[model samples]
Target: MPLSTLNKEQLSAATAPIGNNLIIASAGTGKTSTIVGRIAHLLQTGIEPSKILLLTFTNKAAGEMLERVGRYFPAVVVNKIESGTFHAVSYRWLKQINKNVTLKQPTELKTLFRSIYEKRQFKRLNHDVEAFSSTYLYEQYNLYQNASLDGFDIWFIDKYPDHKPLIDIYMNIIDEYEDTKDRFGFVSFNDLLIKMRQSLLENRREMQEVLVDEYQDTNTLQSALIDSIQSNSLFCVGDYDQSIYAFNGANIQNIATFGKRYNDATVFTLSKNYRSTASILSLANRVIERNERIYPKKLEVTRVSKNYPPKLLIYKELFDQYQAIARNIKNSYTPSNDIAVIFRNNASADGVEASLRELGINCKRKGGNSFFEAKEVKFLLDVLSLIVNPKDMMAFIHIFEYGKGIGTAVAKEMFECFIHFGEGHLFTGMLSPRVFNLPKLNPTKNMQLGLFDDDTQIGSISRFAHLKLSEQIKSNPILKHPKLTDDGLIFFKNFYDFLKSIKNVKQPQTMIIKLINTPLYEGIVEMLSNQRAKLKSGEIDPDKK
Candidate 1:
């Protein structure tokens, strides 16, 4: 059936303005289509695009919404419509409102200090590389970032003993960073929301309407930004079950308490599950029934099929679980099988990847480059790309090129090490250089090593390299002495052994199984366990299915 056949009452509850509006959209229920259509409907009804601000949680989502609306209403002007991730929109507003507000670039937070760690910066942070672990120092700076973005009270730092000193030091550096950014007219993602909230408060009368998408992901500051605008009408769309951004500080309470907070607020529930088979929907519903206080919605599937009842498996050990799943898929799995292994965390994908790869199955990670694009890994690769071919100027200068306060003596040492060792040299051997001459480095070479795939799969390569290092260490009697109590070395060695055994496996499920046995796999398991605990502890309810 065409979307137009769907009744308005079947749409986002935001269409009805009872003062404040809350929409609970279910999974695979055309949430984006409904949102875009709503925007088009609002426009057709004569709401000025400029007056109706549509806020989303991610830029990609905003872009998609804009494109969708354009398809339906070609003549509508969208340039003035406020549509973007909360940070992107906020940044644009903040740039206009606080012209003098300078921002610290992420590079400032990634600077190197060699007081203790003589190893690579990324490894130092993950393992014990520095005399004083930089994780504490890095997290100290991160607190300021988080506070600036989310407005956590300044006193919150006192709760952590290790962070207190960094907080004290931050009081001085933050001022300097802000001053420098202001002088240069720069802004960071955090600076955007901080400024937007300030702008909305100062110009409250000018604000007319605010429409928020994925309202469940709103943090304290984001919610405040909308509230401070004092808009006459507030419209929000999201389901509590889909609030998956707790790690980024999203407040579930924002969605959970809409009715109580807004006296005239009207709560609307979209009870239809328009995208799943009856069996599939039933399984999902049953699985989520364990969570409490979810809006009561039952799905009735329109289509009937003889497929086996939706399969849900519980395993005592994660390894055994992967083995069982892998065996089933290997016999006759196709790429278009539409198997989605949704995990609570990105790291959880590792084990699944290994298991699938072991079975020679073709599997692509579902998400974007977030896993491989972490600050630590990127910095390490930046250095490697430089040494591999200085002519690869893009990679050569990216290490210390962006961000503030990263060009310190320690940064220079890292750069020099990269220059001294040619591209093919071992990371451990190259980093052991006695002297790093930063000034003598020259980039006049015009050689090119061609292009390389720096995708998420490269992480598997890095893991393999670490595993090889562990084996080489074990072979040396002196280095294998009992004094070495670090389990990291042993785990990586075993991980490499496992990887070698399934080197030809090509399926995601098989690769996942092998990857899970790695030390990193355990870390991911711990994270999942923690999330489960939080769900059980009243912090989150998994039942909003």
Candidate 2:
């Protein structure tokens, strides 16, 4: 909290005259500490607490910075500083003036986009060219809003020239969707910034200084919104190498252009590494240095040395990768619990957990999606569940409705027919075994399957009883049901073939791999590549007051 506690550069930046300032901070270089130091210096220099605005990508970050600031200041002083995420602070400013901001969840907005998309009846387009799928369009629309100030139509056509023929329909659908949102006063997180920027431009706010963290991840719109506050003093801290949100339209240039945008901006570098040894920093610098540098920076390690130089390991298979890591930790002199392996995605954790347990390592995973909650895994589980207990309506619904065109109503109808055919138990009549030596039944007329039903006590074991999934595709009476459309039939046939392939599988890991390859699964995956991410409070229904 004291000025002397900060390093020489940190102290200089914290106490420097603030017209506009950019702090280029690399990973684990005590950026948070410096931000807190800056806040303390502002307070010590008699800047109004009410006029200081702290913005972060997450409220948790803001809370953390303010909590540190609170160590040097009173509750009233810290609370009056107005710290939060861009969306959160913008929503607050808009709500304070009694705007009718109806913030809806991203899923709701996406659903609305989908409904409007379906109304245009784009089952097929040109015979010569491939058309963009609905989900792809939605993704593009979101990208356009976040990435730039240019027209969505222009951006879409420029990026995807093949989609030129389909642009009008897509734009029209978007226009209608926007009109609906306008009519209902529906607002998304992006909308909050746009509205806030517009409002501030018309009537400026009274903030003396704005401080932002992770400024490199901000896209063009966010940068524009930040400038619209009209505060002469700006403090932004970010590292370009740390930028990871490009998929969601993060612009690294925001950090690069900051000094140019504000000609009087003072630029400072926080290059001291307190967390990692020199070896790690050397490897990181080597890797990151290969990329084009927007802002030149070199990290200096506070830790003089490390016992081990970081090794870059490459394996042909994931099993080998996990197996190697697990073995390394298990055989180490240190306790297994003391060693940790971090991965980029939650899906990778599954294999690591399995490999560790194989070596008799007892470990508890902290924050990642478990195998069961996965969509593909859950779908396979539903199939197994329906097979075991035919009357499980939830499992039945999940399995039947998975095929295209089979909604809950049609699935309910399909269930009724299945129950009637199965004689109260699912697959009783359908899964009947095929007697290898006997003559096969006509593939077209499936009602003959009734003669071989397992419930028939009057006859000897029929040749057609106990059908495998592959056999059932052609001979199963369920295939002849009226409610099943052509698309539904195709989905089930593919589903059955996949099921039959994995029906005898003992290893769950193998089955899961096959589950993702199923035509039904592949279609869904192709349509929607990015799995639904866990929504933050900013993305979900924000306060509509």
Candidate 3:
């Protein structure tokens, strides 16, 4: 904690707060600690915690900042201090201050196309109708629509004014969203900053000092919010070179433009790598050097790890790349250790997963949607619906057997059985019913079957199921009852708590699955495998076996 122990650059960056401050931290450069130290120093110098508005890009980051501050200086901080992701903090602002704030309806691109078709505005294009019916279409529509507005928010829209008709429609929807949210007490993630900025714009006296973390990741709305709340001081720290979220509206140029925008601004750079080995820092520096708009900062490492020159294998083909990576892992990787494979797209990881599985390498994709999108998750959601209302049995089964292509006749018969009997019976009699409608077949009588007992491991269903159940228990206020000790509930609560405790700061799923590894979770894995095998090996005996 001594000034002498600190690197010269860190010391210099921390002390120099003349105007606007920007700290460019290279990978493994102790970025969080430096940020925390800066905040601590300000607090030590008699800057009241309430006056400081610290913003992060994620809830996890906010949580971490709070935790760090609590550890460093607890009593000085207020209980409900303003700090969170830009979206979260903004949302809170809207809720607390904006009485008339409203959220827009989240419509997919397909929905927009359908609206266009219904309104007779769009004839089917020669291109693939399916492609037209995508989330991209909606994004494009939003871009087109929001591009024509007069204000800075609509600068993009105004630049492309030819899309005025679409812009008018989209703007109306955005306005309606605000109105509807105000009418029915609903606020969106983005509306937080919008409403707060509006509040300050309408009533400027309420503005206060602001401090934003990861300034490189600030979007237009967030920067605008900071601009609106520009009073005491604007302190932001980030490295534009580490800006990886350009796809998600993050504007790295904002960091570059901070001085020009804010006439009274100071820029500082932190260039000491404290987290990684010297070799790793060298590689990271080399990789990011290619990126333009990079601040002039050199990351020099003091600690040198024994491991040097982190492997960078490049293969000829995509499959070869995957196989080579997997093979390398097979040779050197250990189980239960963190090994990240970063990708620009989800599609790129699919082949890696496939190739890794082929090599019998037990690897999991770290960050992308895992547990939520699994087949088992769909199955559990279906089951939950069926349990809540037995009439939704067909719907449940359709979701459960989604990829298998269940026929209408088979679906109807299943529905009929569910109406007559119950989910427990239908589950027990899965093999007995002629779901495929061949000759009368009753496979359930032959296979040992019984009601889904409370003791059976439910987590063993699927990653999706496990994730859904975990999320449900975590989010649902009603289900947190102390008396609920049923076997399924016990399994769910235990896994949920475990997953919650091992919360991911960056790669969320990495921590989630790491938390989910237990006997109960293993059972869920087995159940999913058995279900797949049942269909593949003619063991279920329902359709044709």
**What are the RMSD figures for all models against the true structure?**
16.3, 15.7, 15.9
- Of candidate 3, the 10-residue stretch with the lowest lDDT total is 443-452
lDDT of the candidates, in the order given: 0.56, 0.74, 0.54
Runs in model 2 lying further than 4 Å from the true structure: 98-100, 124-128, 304-306, 335-337, 368-545
Per-residue lDDT over 96-167 for candidate 2, one digit per residue giving the tens place of the 0 to 100 score: 865776786675566567645554434334335555666778778888888989899898888988877777
Q: Kindly give the number of clashing pairs for every candidate.
A: 29, 9, 17
Native-referenced Cα lDDT, model 2: 0.74
lDDT of 1 by residue, 52-156 (tens): 788887788888878867766654487667878777776666767655654544554344322112222232123222223445544544544533453323544
Give the lowest summed-lDDT range of ten residues in model 1. 449-458
Ranking by lDDT: 2, 1, 3
Candidate order by TM-score, decreasing, is 2, 3, 1
Using all chains and alpha carbons, the TM-scores for the candidates as numbered come to 0.58, 0.67, 0.60
* lDDT comparing candidate 3 with the true structure: 0.54
